[model samples]
Target: MLKKSGLSFLWLSAVAFVIDLASKYLVVKNFQLYESINLLPVFNLTYVRNYGAAFSFLAEHSGWQKFFFIGLALVISGVLIFWLAKNPINKKLQNTAYALVIGGALGNMVDRSYHGFVVDFLDFYWDIYHYPVFNFADVFICIGAGLLIWDSFKNKETSE
Candidate 1:
C-alpha cells in the first residue's frame, strides 16, 4: 500500500483524468464539426479531432501515425508517473504538474488509441492569427510544462 501522500498523487491523477474527459465529452456532444462558437473576443469553441501530434503535426499521414503517437504518449506518461513517485511529496506544485501531464497524456492517448485522434474544441484567435484548437488535456500538459520550466529556471538562479 502507498503512503497518504502517494495516494494523494494518485487522487490528483484521477481528478485530472475526470476533468479532462468530462470537458472533452461536453465539447464533443455540444459542438458541431468545424463550427465555431465564439466565447470571447479572442477565443472560440470549435470541435476538431486531431490525428497527429501537437498542433496536428503529421495529421496528414495515412493512418499509422495515430497508433504511433498513442504509444509515444503511453511511454511518456509512464515515465512521468515513475518520476512523480520518486519525487518528494512536499513539492506540491511539482507533483501537481506531473499529475496534470500524466493525466492529460493519458486522456489524449485514450482518444488516439480508440478513436484514432483527439477531440479538440478550444480555439483562440485574434483577427488573422489563430492558435491551435485544443482541449483540457492539452491545457494541463502545457501548464505542466510551463511550471516545470519555471521551476528549472528558479533552481538555476538559486544555485548560481
Candidate 2:
C-alpha cells in the first residue's frame, strides 16, 4: 500500500496557495473596501476583510484575535506538514485533503501577518440576504474539509 510518499502531492498545496494569493491580489488591486460588482443575480465580487475566523467569529475583539489566529494556523500547518510527510502516497484522498488545508492555512496566515486580516471577495446573496463574503483560501479549506469527511466514511466502509 505504501508506494510513493505523500510529499509528491505537495504541489497541490502550492497550487492552492498560489491561486488564493493571486485571486486576492487581483481583488485588492481592482477593488476598494466595500466595493461590489454584481456578476450574477446571486453572486458578486465584493471586497472585504475578515478579522476573525469563519463568519467573522470574534471579529469584535480588540485585535488579539489576529495574533491568535496566526499562531493557530502556524500550529496547524506544522501538524499538517508532519502528517503529510509520514502519510503513504497511496492515501490520495487523505493527502490531497491535507495539502489543500495546508495551502489555505498558509494563505490566511500570510494575510494575517501582512495585512492584519484575510481578504474576502466572493459574495453570494439572495434578494435581501447575503452569505458571508469569502475568498479562495476559504474555498480550498472547505473543499479539503469535505474531502476529509468523505475519506473518513470511505475508510470506515473499507475497514468494516
Q: Each candidate's lDDT (Cα)?
A: 0.83, 0.93
Model 2's TM-score against the true structure:
0.94
lDDT of 1 by residue, 34-120 (tens): 888888999998988898889889999999898788888889888887787777787677788888888888988887777778999
Best by lDDT: 2
Error of 1 at 30 (Å): 1.9
Query: TM-score for each prediction?
Result: 0.89, 0.94
- In model 2, the worst 10-residue window by lDDT is 1-10
How well does model 2 score by local distance difference test? 0.93
Model 2 / residue 41 / CA error / Å: 0.9
